[model samples]
Target: MAQKKARKAESSSQRGKAQKKKAAGQAARAATRSEEVSGIQAFIKYLKEVRVEFEKITWATKKETIGVTVAVLAITFFFAAYLGLVDFSLTKILGLLY
Candidate 1:
């Protein structure tokens, strides 16, 4: 009874391996037969798809865009001024040490 069960398991394992090999061979053949698109053509198609998708999106108005841009610029200028002050102070201290 044990030998019978062992034989059954061995047979199933062999069948599984055979099925897997058949699938792998079929996949390799299909891949070799598949037509490949060029990178530029694929990129252009992707961009067109994205543009259409963006058209579906509701974006902020020009006024909102301008407001956000101005706020970002103000924050940028403030950070730049702060960094410049720190840099100047450090440079002055280093100069005194020299």
Candidate 2:
């Protein structure tokens, strides 16, 4: 009868250990879920901040944009022509030397 009681106690102890391990696993999973939720919340907050900053920007008007674009194109063309003339002149001088 004492041996039977010892066996029952040992079995109960093992079951208790298993239950504790299961609880620990559940707690860890809960912590992971909370961290995931907090990460998503932080990303949403960052996006909201970006949107607020975007609204504060001063965008150029269509007329100003067109004027700036035209100025840039004109300057680009002028530089391209100047560089082409310089390159041609250098090539002719090098040819004569050779």
Candidate 3:
């Protein structure tokens, strides 16, 4: 019957639309997966470069490191003592004035 044929045609068109939508969804998922892979690859490449640069560094010897630490400690103690003396002198002078 003509009505039966028309129904079949309508059903086929709907199936075609559904198939297209499914294919588009699959393509979008594929694109997103590829982007994630590329991002991971870029990060791995950056880490490799950082490792290579780290290997090229010239670290200080133990003696040099100790010398620098001692110098820093000496300077810190000197400044601390100087500041404490200044603060105590100022406090006493202010107390006398008050």
Candidate 4:
């Protein structure tokens, strides 16, 4: 049983190494293929890919955008008031010390 477990682990490790080498070879081939493409062709390919990726994006609706904007404004107002209060208190304390 112990030997079986050890053999299993060894085989899995070897398989992992083989997979890594296979992936590396595929990447090398892809790089060579890309290198063979003309510059303008590569640019057009890049633009096409960008457009495809943009098509996959899920944009926020107007309602969602307005809600986020309102939330941000409220948080900003609260923080500004809090910081102003702290600054006033510190200034009063320092004035008394002087």
TM-score top scorer: 4
Once model 3 is optimally superposed onto the true structure by TM-score, how far is the C-alpha of residue 93 displaced, in angstroms? 0.7
Cα error, residue 82 of model 1, in Å, equals 0.7
Q: Candidate 4's residue-wise lDDT over 1-98, tens digit each?
A: 99999999999999999999999999999999877978898899999999999999999999999999999999999999999999999999999999
For all predicted structures, in order, the TM-scores are 0.57, 0.62, 0.62, 0.65
Please identify model 4 stretches exceeding 4 Å from their true place: 1-35
Pairs of residues clashing in candidate 2: none
Worst 10 residues of 2 by lDDT: 33-42
Q: Which runs in model 3 stand beyond 4 Å of their true positions?
A: 1-37
Residue-wise lDDT of candidate 3 within 8-95, one digit each (tens)?
A: 9999999999999999999999998877757788899999999999999999999999999999999999999999999999999999
| Predicted structure 3, TM vs. truth | 0.62
Please tell me which predicted candidate would have the highest lDDT against the true structure: 4
Q: lDDT tens string, model 2, 1-98?
A: 99999999999999999999999999999999876757788899999999999999999999999999999999999999999999999999999999
Models sorted by TM-score, best on top? 4, 2, 3, 1
- Tell how far residue 54 is off in model 4, in angstroms: 0.5
Runs in model 2 deviating more than 4 A are: 1-37
lDDT minimum window of 10 residues, candidate 3 = 33-42
